[model samples]
Each structure stands twice: as C-alpha cells, then as structure tokens.
Target: MKPAAILEAALYVDDLAEAERFYGQVLGLDLLAKAEGRHVFFRCGDTVLLLFDPKATEVPPEAGARLPVPPHGAHGPGHLCFSAGAAEIELWKKHLEDHNVAIEADFEWPRGGRSIYFRDPSGNSLEFAEPRIWSFT
Candidate 1:
C-alpha cells in the first residue's frame, strides 16, 4: 500500500537556538517542542517541521536509553520546499525581505506558478512555491 501524506519534514541545523528564532520568529511557524542543543519542532499547518542538531543525532543513543530512535542525519546543506499559493508566495517574499532574509532565486516556472528560494542560517536551501508547480491541485 502507498503511504498517505507527509506528516513531518526534518532539516539539519548546527545551532538549535538560531534555528528556533528563524523558524519560530522569522517564518512564523508555531513552536511545537524543543530540546536545547538538540532539536526544535514546529507546526506547519498540516505538517511538522523538525530542525535537528546533526551533532547530537548522528550518534546512536546509548544502550538502554529511554527513546532508542536510530541515529540519522545529513551533512552539508539540504533542501526543503514549502507549498504555497500564488498570493501566499508573494506575501512570503515580502515578509522574508522585511526580515532581512535574502532571496537567492525567484522566478516563474515555464509551465506555471512561481517559486522563491532562500537559505536558512545553517545554509540549507529553503523554497516556497505554488503547489501547481508540480500540478498539485
């Protein structure tokens, strides 16, 4: 059977506090939970955005640990794109600019819709695009 929808998305960050400020303060995602020097979780409408400290997650949990989630992480910059409507994308562009976040790329897709790309403090590529870019209704 095919999986349903994505419930959460994760991104690796070196600084949890900085990440918290960016996602919570700048992007306006509601804070869900956070562990200092570890990870920060945010609510993004129907899904959750998980910002993790790679240094902490790359190592396996000690034997007999309370939560024995397997070690998982990524190195260097990763990418995450948020789905938005045409109007919302425009508003987001302005909001990001007001926050002094540089927009690295902005353009319309050859087929349709628009997308803007930017980087978080940790250098992960973040994008906002009309879902129509992929022909999603």
Candidate 2:
C-alpha cells in the first residue's frame, strides 16, 4: 500500500526555545510538545513539525525492544513548505513582516500561484505557497 500523506517533517535547530517561540508565536503554529534539551514540536495543519536538537537526536537510541522505529535525526538546516490559500498570500506577507521576519524571495509560479520563501532562526529555509502552485494540488 502506498503511504497516505506526510505526517511529520523535522528540522534540527541549535536553540529549542528560540525555535519554539518563532514557530509558535511568530508563525502562529500551535505548540504540540517540548522535551527540554531535546526537541520541540508544533502542529502545522494536519502535519507535525519537529524541531530537534541535533546533538541530542543524532545519537541513536540504545538498542531497545521498546521502539519499533529507531530515532533518526539530521544535520544542518532543513526545508519545509506550507500550503496557504490564495486569499491569504498578501496577508501572510504582511504578517511576516509585522513580526520582523524578512522575506528572502517571492515568486509567482508559471503554473498559477505564488510563494514566499524565508528562513527560520536556525537558518532552515521555509516556504509558504498557495496550493495551486504545485501540479498535484
């Protein structure tokens, strides 16, 4: 069977608290959970965004019989794209700027839609796009 959809996306960050505030307060995502010195999770629509501590998560869990899937982590910055409505594009730009977030790039897709790219506090690239930009949508 094919996988249904992406349930989660992860990015490693140097500071968990800063990431939490940026995602929760600035981006307006709901904070899901946080493990001190380990990770912070946020709810982005139906998907969960995980901000992990590279130093903590890079070390694989001890050989255990508990978890079926071992913990995995990545290094450096990661990227994530979020979907927004056509009507919300302008509002999103204003909101981001109001929060002092710099918009690195803005583009109108030839297919039909628009996207705004920016970076998180940890330097991970993040994008917001109108759903119609992608062919699958």
Candidate 3:
C-alpha cells in the first residue's frame, strides 16, 4: 500500500532552545512540544517537525523502560522544503527579512515556479516554494 503523506520530519540540532525560538518565534510555527534537553517538536501544517539532540537521542536508552519508537538521530545539516502560494512568496520573503533571516538564494525554477532558501538556527536548509514548483496542482 502506498503511504498517504509525510507525518513528520526530523532534524538534529545542538541547541533545542535556539531551535524553539527560531522556529516558534521567528518562523511562526506552532510549538507542539519540548522534551527538555532531548527534543523539540513543532507543527508545520499537517506535518510535524522534530528537532532532536544528536547526543541525547543517538544512544539507546538503558534497559527496562524504552521508547516505543527507538530514537533515530541524524548528524550534519538537513533540508526541508515547504509549499507556498504564488502570491504569498513575496510576503514570505519580506517576513523572513523582517526577522533578520538572510535569504541564501531565490530562484525561478525552469519548470515554472519560484523558491527562497534560508537556514535555521542549527544550519538546516529551509525552503519555501510555490505550489507549482513541484507541480502540486
């Protein structure tokens, strides 16, 4: 059976508080949860963004109690692209700039859409593109 859609995406960060501030305050994503020094979760539309601490999540927990889903941590920077309406693209760029986030690059895709790329506090590459960028509709 084919999967419906992505439920969550994970990114490893060295600083959870900084991630929380950047995502929740700067990016305006809803803060779903934060597990102290372990991880921080944010709601990105229907999907969830999970930021975990590599050092905390990479090591398997001691015997006895264990997480239902074992931690799967990643290292280095990651990338996540979000869909935006054509008219909202400019607004998004302005919003990002207003928040002091630099636009790494902005491009008009040959296929017929535009995208803006930027980095999160942890250096994960984040992108926002017109829905048609991937021929979504």
In order of listing, the candidates' clash counts read 0, 0, 0
The TM-score obtained by model 2 is 0.91
Worst 10 residues of 3 by lDDT: 62-71
Off by over 4 Å in 2: 63-71
lDDT of 3 at 84: 91
Candidate ordering by TM-score (highest first): 1, 3, 2
lDDT of 1 by residue, 1-86 (tens): 99899999999998889999999899989999998888999999899999999999988999999999999999899999998998
Q: Write the per-residue lDDT of candidate 3 for residues 19-81, one digit (tens) a residue.
A: 999999988899989999999999999999999999888777676765645757888899999
Q: After superposition, how far is residue 33 of candidate 2 from its true place, in Å?
A: 1.0
TM-score of each: 0.95, 0.91, 0.93
Clashing residue pairs, candidate 3? none
Candidate 2, after superposition: displacement of residue 97 in Å?
A: 0.7
lDDT of each: 0.94, 0.88, 0.90
Indicate which candidate wins on lDDT: 1
Q: Which ten residues in a row have the lowest lDDT in candidate 1?
A: 128-137
Candidates 1 and 3: which is better by TM-score?
Answer: 1
Tens digits of per-residue lDDT for model 2, 1-137: 99999999889998999999999998999998998999999998889998999888766676764644456777777888889877787888899999999999999998888999988999999999988877794
**Model 2: how far is 84 from its true place, Å?**
0.6
Off-target runs (Cα >4 Å) in candidate 1 are none
RMSD each, Å: 1.2, 1.7, 1.5
